[model samples]
Target: SKMFYGGVKPEMVSDKFSFTEGPSTDKEGNVYFTDQPNDKIYYWDWKTNKVIEFLNKTGRANGTHFDKDDFLITCSDDQGEIWKISKDKKVEVLFKGFEGKRLNGPNDVWNDSFGGMYFTDPLYERDYWVDFKQETP
Candidate 1:
Protein backbone atom coordinates (compact mmCIF):
# COMPACT_ATOMS: atom_id res chain seq x y z
CA SER A 1 0.00 0.00 0.00
CA LYS A 2 2.98 2.33 0.25
CA MET A 3 2.92 2.92 -3.50
CA PHE A 4 -0.81 3.64 -3.59
CA TYR A 5 -0.25 7.03 -5.19
CA GLY A 6 3.22 6.43 -6.54
CA GLY A 7 4.57 7.70 -3.24
CA VAL A 8 3.04 11.11 -3.90
CA LYS A 9 1.68 12.53 -0.68
CA PRO A 10 -1.45 14.60 -0.57
CA GLU A 11 -0.84 18.31 -0.49
CA MET A 12 -3.24 21.17 -0.13
CA VAL A 13 -3.37 23.10 -3.36
CA SER A 14 -5.53 26.04 -2.28
CA ASP A 15 -8.09 27.06 0.30
CA LYS A 16 -10.47 29.82 1.44
CA PHE A 17 -13.77 29.51 -0.29
CA SER A 18 -17.27 29.30 1.06
CA PHE A 19 -18.20 26.19 -0.94
CA THR A 20 -16.82 24.31 -3.92
CA GLU A 21 -18.67 22.39 -6.62
CA GLY A 22 -18.76 21.31 -10.28
CA PRO A 23 -15.40 20.42 -11.79
CA SER A 24 -15.06 20.07 -15.55
CA THR A 25 -12.06 19.41 -17.73
CA ASP A 26 -11.21 21.10 -20.98
CA LYS A 27 -9.80 19.66 -24.19
CA GLU A 28 -6.29 20.45 -23.08
CA GLY A 29 -6.69 18.62 -19.75
CA ASN A 30 -6.99 21.58 -17.45
CA VAL A 31 -9.72 21.37 -14.81
CA TYR A 32 -12.20 24.07 -13.91
CA PHE A 33 -14.21 24.20 -10.67
CA THR A 34 -16.43 26.54 -8.79
CA ASP A 35 -16.76 28.16 -5.37
CA GLN A 36 -20.42 28.91 -5.42
CA PRO A 37 -20.92 30.71 -2.13
CA ASN A 38 -18.13 33.10 -3.05
CA ASP A 39 -19.39 33.36 -6.60
CA LYS A 40 -16.07 32.45 -8.18
CA ILE A 41 -14.53 29.90 -10.50
CA TYR A 42 -10.98 28.56 -10.57
CA TYR A 43 -8.99 26.30 -12.82
CA TRP A 44 -6.00 24.07 -12.38
CA ASP A 45 -3.42 24.69 -15.06
CA TRP A 46 -2.22 21.49 -16.61
CA LYS A 47 1.23 22.78 -17.49
CA THR A 48 1.91 24.88 -14.44
CA ASN A 49 0.07 22.75 -11.87
CA LYS A 50 -1.23 25.92 -10.29
CA VAL A 51 -4.69 27.03 -9.42
CA ILE A 52 -5.85 30.18 -11.18
CA GLU A 53 -8.94 32.26 -10.66
CA PHE A 54 -10.95 32.10 -13.84
CA LEU A 55 -13.88 34.29 -12.91
CA ASN A 56 -15.81 36.04 -10.13
CA LYS A 57 -19.37 37.22 -9.71
CA THR A 58 -20.36 33.96 -11.31
CA GLY A 59 -24.03 33.98 -10.32
CA ARG A 60 -23.57 31.25 -7.70
CA ALA A 61 -22.54 28.75 -10.32
CA ASN A 62 -22.74 25.19 -8.99
CA GLY A 63 -22.16 22.57 -11.71
CA THR A 64 -20.36 22.85 -15.02
CA HIS A 65 -19.47 20.92 -18.15
CA PHE A 66 -17.52 21.99 -21.18
CA ASP A 67 -19.22 22.21 -24.52
CA LYS A 68 -17.75 20.89 -27.76
CA ASP A 69 -16.44 24.35 -28.57
CA ASP A 70 -14.45 24.48 -25.28
CA PHE A 71 -16.88 26.87 -23.69
CA LEU A 72 -17.47 26.30 -19.97
CA ILE A 73 -21.17 25.65 -19.75
CA THR A 74 -22.29 26.49 -16.27
CA CYS A 75 -25.31 26.23 -14.01
CA SER A 76 -25.31 29.82 -12.83
CA ASP A 77 -28.12 29.53 -10.33
CA ASP A 78 -28.12 32.92 -8.68
CA GLN A 79 -30.99 33.94 -10.88
CA GLY A 80 -31.77 30.39 -11.91
CA GLU A 81 -30.09 30.42 -15.32
CA ILE A 82 -27.54 28.61 -17.41
CA TRP A 83 -24.52 30.51 -18.69
CA LYS A 84 -21.97 29.66 -21.31
CA ILE A 85 -18.63 31.20 -20.38
CA SER A 86 -16.10 31.76 -23.11
CA LYS A 87 -12.37 31.49 -22.63
CA ASP A 88 -12.18 35.25 -22.74
CA LYS A 89 -14.57 35.29 -19.74
CA LYS A 90 -17.57 36.33 -21.75
CA VAL A 91 -20.88 35.16 -20.23
CA GLU A 92 -23.94 34.33 -22.29
CA VAL A 93 -27.14 33.36 -20.53
CA LEU A 94 -28.57 30.37 -22.32
CA PHE A 95 -31.72 29.85 -20.30
CA LYS A 96 -33.60 31.61 -17.55
CA GLY A 97 -36.95 29.97 -16.81
CA PHE A 98 -39.72 27.78 -18.10
CA GLU A 99 -43.18 28.95 -19.04
CA GLY A 100 -42.27 32.50 -18.06
CA LYS A 101 -41.71 31.41 -14.47
CA ARG A 102 -38.42 31.60 -12.65
CA LEU A 103 -36.72 28.32 -12.05
CA ASN A 104 -35.81 27.36 -8.52
CA GLY A 105 -32.17 26.88 -9.44
CA PRO A 106 -29.99 25.25 -12.03
CA ASN A 107 -27.84 22.83 -10.06
CA ASP A 108 -26.02 20.94 -12.78
CA VAL A 109 -25.42 20.83 -16.52
CA TRP A 110 -24.41 18.28 -19.12
CA ASN A 111 -23.79 18.77 -22.83
CA ASP A 112 -24.77 16.15 -25.38
CA SER A 113 -22.95 15.28 -28.58
CA PHE A 114 -25.64 16.85 -30.74
CA GLY A 115 -25.04 20.36 -29.36
CA GLY A 116 -27.73 20.12 -26.74
CA MET A 117 -27.63 20.44 -22.99
CA TYR A 118 -29.45 18.80 -20.09
CA PHE A 119 -29.61 20.52 -16.75
CA THR A 120 -31.21 20.10 -13.33
CA ASP A 121 -33.56 22.52 -11.71
CA PRO A 122 -33.67 21.84 -8.01
CA LEU A 123 -35.65 23.68 -5.38
CA TYR A 124 -32.85 23.91 -2.89
CA GLU A 125 -33.24 27.52 -1.94
CA ARG A 126 -30.39 29.90 -1.19
CA ASP A 127 -30.14 32.69 1.30
CA TYR A 128 -29.14 35.16 -1.36
CA TRP A 129 -32.45 34.74 -3.09
CA VAL A 130 -35.12 37.40 -2.63
CA ASP A 131 -38.20 35.23 -2.09
CA PHE A 132 -37.60 31.58 -2.69
CA LYS A 133 -40.41 29.64 -4.36
CA GLN A 134 -40.49 26.54 -6.52
CA GLU A 135 -41.76 27.39 -9.97
CA THR A 136 -41.74 23.75 -10.97
CA PRO A 137 -42.85 20.70 -9.02
Candidate 2:
Protein backbone atom coordinates (compact mmCIF):
# COMPACT_ATOMS: atom_id res chain seq x y z
CA SER A 1 0.00 0.00 0.00
CA LYS A 2 1.10 3.55 -0.65
CA MET A 3 2.18 5.55 2.39
CA PHE A 4 0.07 8.51 1.38
CA TYR A 5 -3.26 9.04 -0.33
CA GLY A 6 -1.87 10.05 -3.69
CA GLY A 7 -5.15 10.92 -5.36
CA VAL A 8 -6.52 13.06 -2.57
CA LYS A 9 -7.23 16.70 -3.34
CA PRO A 10 -7.22 19.67 -1.00
CA GLU A 11 -10.57 20.71 0.40
CA MET A 12 -11.71 23.78 2.32
CA VAL A 13 -12.51 22.67 5.84
CA SER A 14 -13.94 25.81 7.39
CA ASP A 15 -14.38 29.48 6.53
CA LYS A 16 -16.10 30.76 9.65
CA PHE A 17 -13.03 32.25 11.31
CA SER A 18 -11.11 35.42 10.56
CA PHE A 19 -7.52 34.28 10.00
CA THR A 20 -5.98 30.91 10.67
CA GLU A 21 -2.37 30.29 11.65
CA GLY A 22 -0.09 27.83 13.42
CA PRO A 23 -1.43 24.40 12.61
CA SER A 24 -0.05 21.41 14.50
CA THR A 25 -0.94 17.79 15.09
CA ASP A 26 -0.97 15.58 18.11
CA LYS A 27 0.28 12.02 18.39
CA GLU A 28 -3.19 10.75 17.62
CA GLY A 29 -3.25 12.56 14.26
CA ASN A 30 -5.74 15.12 15.45
CA VAL A 31 -4.92 18.47 13.89
CA TYR A 32 -5.03 21.71 15.88
CA PHE A 33 -4.94 25.28 14.58
CA THR A 34 -5.42 28.82 15.76
CA ASP A 35 -7.37 31.81 14.53
CA GLN A 36 -5.40 34.81 15.69
CA PRO A 37 -7.84 37.57 14.92
CA ASN A 38 -10.68 35.73 16.64
CA ASP A 39 -8.66 34.54 19.62
CA LYS A 40 -9.68 30.93 19.20
CA ILE A 41 -8.18 27.54 18.57
CA TYR A 42 -9.81 24.77 16.59
CA TYR A 43 -9.19 21.11 16.07
CA TRP A 44 -9.93 18.59 13.36
CA ASP A 45 -10.73 15.29 14.98
CA TRP A 46 -9.23 12.39 13.09
CA LYS A 47 -11.99 9.95 14.02
CA THR A 48 -14.97 12.21 13.48
CA ASN A 49 -13.54 14.34 10.67
CA LYS A 50 -15.13 17.37 12.20
CA VAL A 51 -13.65 20.78 12.93
CA ILE A 52 -14.57 21.93 16.41
CA GLU A 53 -13.60 24.83 18.65
CA PHE A 54 -10.93 23.58 20.99
CA LEU A 55 -10.40 26.85 22.84
CA ASN A 56 -11.74 30.40 22.91
CA LYS A 57 -10.35 33.64 24.29
CA THR A 58 -6.97 32.22 23.36
CA GLY A 59 -4.90 35.37 23.98
CA ARG A 60 -4.55 36.07 20.27
CA ALA A 61 -2.35 33.09 19.69
CA ASN A 62 -0.50 33.01 16.41
CA GLY A 63 1.56 29.81 16.52
CA THR A 64 1.13 26.44 18.11
CA HIS A 65 2.67 23.00 18.54
CA PHE A 66 1.96 19.81 20.40
CA ASP A 67 4.56 18.93 22.96
CA LYS A 68 5.69 15.43 23.77
CA ASP A 69 3.29 15.30 26.71
CA ASP A 70 0.37 16.13 24.40
CA PHE A 71 0.06 19.67 25.66
CA LEU A 72 -0.87 22.37 23.16
CA ILE A 73 1.91 24.97 23.28
CA THR A 74 0.78 28.32 21.97
CA CYS A 75 2.31 31.70 21.28
CA SER A 76 0.02 34.06 23.14
CA ASP A 77 1.01 37.23 21.37
CA ASP A 78 -1.58 39.44 22.97
CA GLN A 79 0.37 39.35 26.22
CA GLY A 80 3.70 38.27 24.78
CA GLU A 81 3.62 34.97 26.63
CA ILE A 82 3.88 31.32 25.72
CA TRP A 83 1.03 29.20 26.94
CA LYS A 84 0.47 25.50 27.38
CA ILE A 85 -3.00 24.10 27.15
CA SER A 86 -3.60 20.64 28.47
CA LYS A 87 -6.05 17.97 27.33
CA ASP A 88 -8.51 19.02 29.99
CA LYS A 89 -8.42 22.62 28.75
CA LYS A 90 -6.29 24.03 31.52
CA VAL A 91 -3.99 26.89 30.53
CA GLU A 92 -0.52 27.59 31.88
CA VAL A 93 2.02 30.23 31.08
CA LEU A 94 5.23 28.54 30.03
CA PHE A 95 7.18 31.72 29.27
CA LYS A 96 6.49 35.32 30.09
CA GLY A 97 9.33 37.71 29.21
CA PHE A 98 13.06 38.18 28.95
CA GLU A 99 15.10 40.36 31.34
CA GLY A 100 12.11 42.45 32.37
CA LYS A 101 11.28 43.23 28.76
CA ARG A 102 8.30 41.88 26.90
CA LEU A 103 8.88 39.60 23.98
CA ASN A 104 8.35 40.97 20.49
CA GLY A 105 5.98 38.15 19.54
CA PRO A 106 6.35 34.45 19.28
CA ASN A 107 5.55 33.43 15.74
CA ASP A 108 6.19 29.67 15.61
CA VAL A 109 7.49 26.85 17.71
CA TRP A 110 9.06 23.38 17.45
CA ASN A 111 9.94 20.79 20.04
CA ASP A 112 13.08 18.68 19.97
CA SER A 113 13.34 15.09 21.07
CA PHE A 114 15.19 16.20 24.19
CA GLY A 115 12.14 18.15 25.43
CA GLY A 116 13.53 21.49 24.35
CA MET A 117 11.43 24.02 22.51
CA TYR A 118 12.51 26.66 19.97
CA PHE A 119 10.45 29.54 18.69
CA THR A 120 10.70 32.72 16.69
CA ASP A 121 10.21 36.20 18.09
CA PRO A 122 9.44 38.96 15.70
CA LEU A 123 8.28 42.53 16.24
CA TYR A 124 5.10 43.67 14.57
CA GLU A 125 3.15 46.77 15.47
CA ARG A 126 -0.48 46.02 16.21
CA ASP A 127 -3.42 48.40 16.30
CA TYR A 128 -4.09 47.66 19.94
CA TRP A 129 -0.70 48.88 21.01
CA VAL A 130 -0.23 52.45 22.10
CA ASP A 131 3.40 52.99 21.12
CA PHE A 132 5.33 50.09 19.72
CA LYS A 133 7.82 49.81 16.92
CA GLN A 134 8.73 46.89 14.71
CA GLU A 135 12.38 46.18 15.28
CA THR A 136 14.79 43.38 14.56
CA PRO A 137 16.49 41.60 17.45
- The TM-scores of all predictions, comma-separated, are 0.89, 0.89
Predicted structure 2, TM vs. truth: 0.89
**Once model 2 is optimally superposed onto the true structure by TM-score, how far is the C-alpha of residue 96 displaced, in angstroms?**
1.2
Clashes of each: 0, 0
Model 2: residues with Cα > 4 Å off, grouped in runs: 1-4, 130-136
Q: After superposition, how far is residue 66 of candidate 1 from its true place, in Å?
A: 0.3
Q: Where does candidate 1 clash, by residue pair?
A: none
Q: Cα RMSDs of all predictions?
A: 2.4, 2.6
| Candidate 2: tens digits of C-alpha lDDT, residues 1-137 | 66548888677777888889999999999999998888899999979879999999988889999988989999988877899999889999988787777888788998877789999888876666556544336
Over 62-89, each residue of candidate 1 has an lDDT whose tens digit, in order, gives 9999998999999988899899999999
Error of 2 at 72 (Å): 0.6
